[model samples]
Target: MSLPLNEQTVLVTGAGRGLGAAIAAAFAREGASVAVNYRNSGKAAENLASCLGGKASAFGADVRDGEAVAQMVANVKVRLGAPTTIVHNALADFSFNGDARSKLDALTWDEIAAHMETGVKGALNLIQAAAPSMRERGFGRIVLIGTNLFQNPVVPYHDYTAAKAALLSLTRTAAAELGPFGITVNMVSGGLLRTTDASSATPEAVFDLIAGSTPLRRVTTPEEMADAVLFFASPWSRAVTGQNLIVDGGLVFN
Candidate 1:
């Protein structure tokens, strides 16, 4: 049987601020026990947990580290419960100013590797750590946080976009392998979200440009995109798996 939202424990990585925090808040609003995972911003994470109330708690773990992530998962099981849902929302340090972004000529392998460490390897570590209990329970939900830049590439944030594309591939293959065990893997890709900490660097003109182009005549918000994540974790999407749900206010039709 599928676990109800109130009965499930959800671990949202890199949730100390911005979009990740919004995602964690959405899950908490639905009565799920939320593990707000942060790599460095403990105070922010703690503050969010206190505000969330009802089984929400802060945890620190560099998602890039396998052992640390596993240990964090273990600790979560003790403090909350075995995590049945994972929203891999961690992001490498980045500022969304296309004017300052690296051009292909200046971009290095190390730049690309940084995003991969969190987006790809982090997902692998999380699945390895949390999948056992989920498999035993015959149910799980893995929602990867992705970007619409790969499709739109309006600004061509090469390193960040490449890593998310790789995550999309992993999302499909992982879904096929884990589906028989009742664990669904999917991706929620959002376009340049309005007012995220990273996107705060984006100029006002840029937001206006995007808003004008999108069919909805507005840029997506972190809270709105976060709500799309809840759909994947809920029983309503029981038949859905390996799909990439774009929540960009009709900016990208995928």
Candidate 2:
């Protein structure tokens, strides 16, 4: 469905704060009714909703819980219309303190599962819940958030990077399955963002080093990455799917 920006209703997972909030606000700015899904940050989510005006509302649900995700989608349907666009920006709680992160040998199965619970499983829940409505209407937009680690494992964030890699696979497979239903599934990944809740733990020098390394000579911002996500949701990317676009400034060329 090549729906206009104003005619779309967007569901942005983990949209209470940080990068998620930026994505939600970006959708609202485009005149779409925004369902800001938050798992824990209710107050922050509520405040964001208020700031977004009447077109946006905050809904809390653990994406890891399939039933909860289904129910969340139902609530969004009644309140802001069924979400025709879904941006799975939700992430497991993690900080980008590479120095303190576990290496491959130290990483346990449990650690890996935790990230997948929110990254892969959460994405599965949202896709399943939204597929029915999307197929029925013959239009849907699903954008999964990814990372540039696949090309350049700059940090030893083993579990986190692994989870995102799985999500990338899901993106392509889902795109193949849902393309017939007028649903476009894609991924938008970025390099270590300049400043976000998760990346706050990163050292200042690391940021400076990364900025110097990039061709743009600056770190990407959450807001900038949010705009790239909008492309997949908008009509401009009508012919694009099963693809991952890296928004980092010449960090990793894939």
lDDT for 44 in candidate 2 is 98
Residue 78 shift from truth in candidate 2, angstroms: 0.3
Query: Candidate 2 has what TM-score?
Result: 0.99
TM-score of each: 0.99, 0.99
Model 2 is weakest, by summed lDDT over 10 consecutive residues, at 149-158
Question: Residues 8-112, candidate 2, lDDT per residue (tens digit)?
Answer: 999999999999999999999999999999999999999999999999999999999999999999999999999999999999989999898988778799989
Model 2 pairs whose backbones collide: none
lDDT of 1 by residue, 75-127 (tens): 99999999999999999999999999999999999999999999999999999
Q: Please report how far candidate 2 places residue 50 from its true position, in Å.
A: 0.4
Positional deviation of residue 242's Cα in model 1 after best superposition, in angstroms: 0.6
Per-candidate local distance difference test: 0.96, 0.95
The CA lDDT at 185 in model 2 is 98
Best candidate, lDDT-wise? 1
